[model samples]
Target: MKVLLTGATGFIGSKLLPVLTQEKYDVYTIGRSNLDYAKHTKLDLKDNFAIENLMQSLKPDICLNLAWFVKHKIYWNSDENLDCLSLSTKLMKEFYKNNPNGIFYGFGTFYQYLHDTHIGNNLYTKSKIKTYEILKDFASLSNYKTSWGFIHNVYGKGEPSEKIISYLITKLRNKEEVFVQNPFNKFDFINVVDIANQIFYAIKNNYIGDFDICYGTSFTTQEIAYMICDILNVSKDLIKINHQSDQKFEISSKPLDIYKNINIKDRLCEMIDNL
Candidate 1:
């Protein structure tokens, strides 16, 4: 089947690309930078006309959207969240217009399930919720076999350099003193590979609607810092662990589900060594 992938160069998308290709699904990627693969288009996803033109060209059987305004700490209140939502809506419409019975999968976030108090307080969360609702509503009325994957605290290869794991790796490699903040905030992190695997499993098994994409485990920032220290065989004394609230929030204290089939511990050495 022809598959159109948005955010193919991103943390999660990059991981999923190989999985899809290995499974032999005809894949087309979208990005501003030229992709290594031949079947890709570099254009503005916000441009409705561009989407129409591209959809007319590929007419994919499935569209997996992993793009969004995720600029680390800045995305929570960014106006770009609205733009992503708009782009997603346009893509869905164009996809349906081209292949009426095709599949359209998008990524949601754990923030969408946070207490109602966070709704008006976060544009990123609010925008994602809006997109999720739109997909569900459209799917109910049309033949778009859409699915929404809710994920949070993702880490792995190709992740942003500022991410916790990446940060620790860089600092430890440089022998710089690293500070562990939000010592009590237990965040569950899913590997990009695992997230990609889950997405494929959902599509292959015909799983529809919304579902949580959790690693089924959690570790505190301090714990994670030490994990890196151990992996690097560096002195933990070079790290400072503080109890102060880091203000970095996560979805919950424990995973909503315990899907620890893939261990982050097993993957860390390879990811760190490679990066």
Candidate 2:
């Protein structure tokens, strides 16, 4: 299989490429930076004509898009949201027009929920929600094969930001105190490797439509902190829970139904241990 991958240097994309290449698939990666993979291409997706040219040249069987502007903080704001839809829509339309049979994979955030009313009042969440809505709309109308993966907290090596698990591991390794906000609030987390594996499965198996890509376990930040502390044989007392300044968004109670297809919870701790 020939696959064109965007955001090839991202947390999920980085881990996914090695596995896809090892499976004997020709992986063509498009990114701002060059990387060693099945193939390399520098693509500025904002340019529709350029993207169309690349799609016509590569003639890939699949296009896995992961590129997006993201902020680390949950409550941060950005003016980029105004143009996010235009850029993504243009890229998708060009890809779909060029290769109508090619599989189009879209990445969405699990935090973007409609039923769950206890949502965060932040621009990041709003933008993710808007992007997800567009993806859903695209999947519904597009003739080509389309799939959207709503991902939760993904942590592993090469994490762009210092996630809770990364922060805990660092603090424990240093024998220093760790501070966290709302440790009691439960959140969904997934190992980046597992997420990558599932992406391959979804493509190979021809999974079509929207899917919740997650490990299907909700653990509190405090629980994760203790898990890391236990792994390092450190005192849990060193972990301190701090309160957020503005608001208290309730824990994510969105029940993702990935259990019917696959779940990566069993290997969660083992993966963390290896990290």
Candidate 3:
């Protein structure tokens, strides 16, 4: 299968590339920077004409859309979210136009769920929800086979320093105080490698529709912090938990058991030791 991947240099995509290659798929990547492992095309996703032209030429059997504006706290309200949403939708349309029988897989977020309480309401979340809806609707109209994977917190080595896991790991390694504002906030963290494997599994099985790419487990901020502290043999007292901040809970739909063999604590330990 000829696979086209966006966000090839990202935290998840970087890990996913090897998995696809190991499966012997002819992979092509699009990114701002050139990827060393595969046939990479350096192109800006925001340019519709360039994207359409590339899609027409490649006509890949599968397109995995993972590109987005993912700057830490700023992405919640950044206008780049809207721009990414538009670009992603345009890419999907072009992909369909070129390869009618091609499969398209989109990465979604847990924040897309509409809860009565506006805990996760933000520009980034809203953009993801809107983008997924638009793409899914378009696929339906065209009778295209599409899969939407709603992901939770994905953590691994080589993540940006601004990410939660990276931040915690740094502080813990330095024996510095880790201040967590919303200690009660619950999250489900899946290893990036596990996420990549699940994506491969879904595509291989020809599964379609919405699925949650997360380990069927959730943890509070304090619990996760202490787990890191325990692994690093650091003082648990260094973790300061403030209960005043708004606590967000991410609920998954159709959670998968693909990551049952992996232990979260062991993963944290390995990441910390590597740092």
Best by lDDT: 3
- Candidate 1 residues lying further than 4 Å off, grouped into runs, are 115-120, 173-175, 243-259
Return the candidate ranking by TM-score, descending. 3, 1, 2
Q: In order, how many clashes per candidate?
A: 0, 0, 0
Instruction: Identify the runs in model 2 with alpha carbons over 4 angstroms from their true place.
Output: 71-76, 81-84, 114-119, 245-275
Which 10 successive residues of model 3 have the least lDDT summed?
Answer: 111-120
lDDT per residue as tens, model 2, 1-275: 78888887877888888888889888888876777754787766566677778877877788888776665653246765545556667667777777778878878776676334444455656766776677667756855678877777777766643767777777777899999887666666777777788788788788887776666567778887887777678999998879764443443433234343344334445655666
In terms of TM-score, which candidate is stronger, 1 or 3?
3
RMSD each, Å: 3.2, 3.5, 2.0
- The number of the candidate with the highest TM-score is 3
The true-versus-predicted C-alpha distance at residue 177 of model 2, in Å, is 1.6
On a 0 to 100 scale, what is the lDDT of residue 15 in model 2? 87
Our tally of clashes for model 3 stands at 0
Q: Candidate 2: worst 10 consecutive residues by lDDT?
A: 253-262
